[model samples]
Target: MAHCQFRLVNGPPQRYIADGVAWVLDPAVGGGGALRNLGIHGVDAALSLATGKLGLKSVSIANRIHPGPVEDHALLVLEDEAGALFIVEAGYTFASMRPGGDFEWRIVSANATLIDHGDHVICATLDDAAIVDLPVELPATRYRLFMRDTLDRLARKAPPPVSIEDYVAAMSLIDAAYQKAGP
Candidate 1:
């Protein structure tokens, strides 16, 4: 792929409450915000599609709306050895009522560009403006599916779908971004 972009934005006013506490606003409790909570998925997705070694290009993090120890928004830019660019953006900044928030995933390659619209994907050829809609089957609740798969694997004595190495690699990137952003 020449370029890949993912955006996970929410409109919940940057505060996550559970039992009368906003634990997500606490850096120590939540580890970090936006990037750590939401952008990690994007990082994992990018890593899955990487052709070669990838390196961090830049990072921008902020808590413009809700000033706290944790950031409410983050943006990261990465580049692979093949010169492909990957951008991941996460934020609690949109204005919507949806609990899951708004999600966008787009991939641009030499032959075509694919834009994910939740239930369908639009593939447009680089040579022509023609587009094709590809239907996809998605679960209404991804968390439920994930939990079911995890439990099934455990029952079958199978290894976890996501390995510790994968988690480490993704977290290392996020740590680097935080370090680059500085205190």
Candidate 2:
């Protein structure tokens, strides 16, 4: 029901890791690179929404990096138990920021299809196929939303948005990806 693409910004100070970054996107410093780090979230959302369960019927991952360890580009083709497909493309090799980078997620169900196509979020119907673009501004700062949600949840004595089980499920998928990313 859902698929998304994430584009990693490759700039001077933000791109590389010499002393620091906002948060290290490197495998050596941050434990996981783009595939295992960024790709997991999209995968989790897709699978969670499609099946309401973390278990995937099948998962195939491919690494498209250079002659090195880090995976700068990766694709995950996943199928849920209900026979829904979730294609996740995560990469750091996005060419430029001109006209905005390609970063979005979409979910298509029997009745309606919801899409966040970087510039706007739209809802399409299956019956009439009418598209209704929503007037919603995507957050500029990524951490701000996470922090606010976490604080609010803590104050309300509610569980975190992402739980330990979610982490486990995501890691399992990553592990499967590594195992299948053959030598």
- lDDT of each model, Cα atoms only? 0.83, 0.62
Q: Stretches of candidate 1 above 4 Å error?
A: 13-15, 18-21, 126-130, 137-140
TM-score, prediction 1? 0.87
Q: Give TM-scores for every candidate, taking all chains together and pairing residue i with residue i.
A: 0.87, 0.77
- After superposition, candidate 2 runs with Cα above 4 Å error: 1-19, 22-29, 52-68, 97-100
Tens-digit lDDT string for candidate 2 (91-139) = 5556653333456777777888777765688998979969898875553
Score residue 14 of candidate 2 by CA lDDT.
30
Candidate 1 lDDT: 0.83
**Best by TM-score, which number?**
1
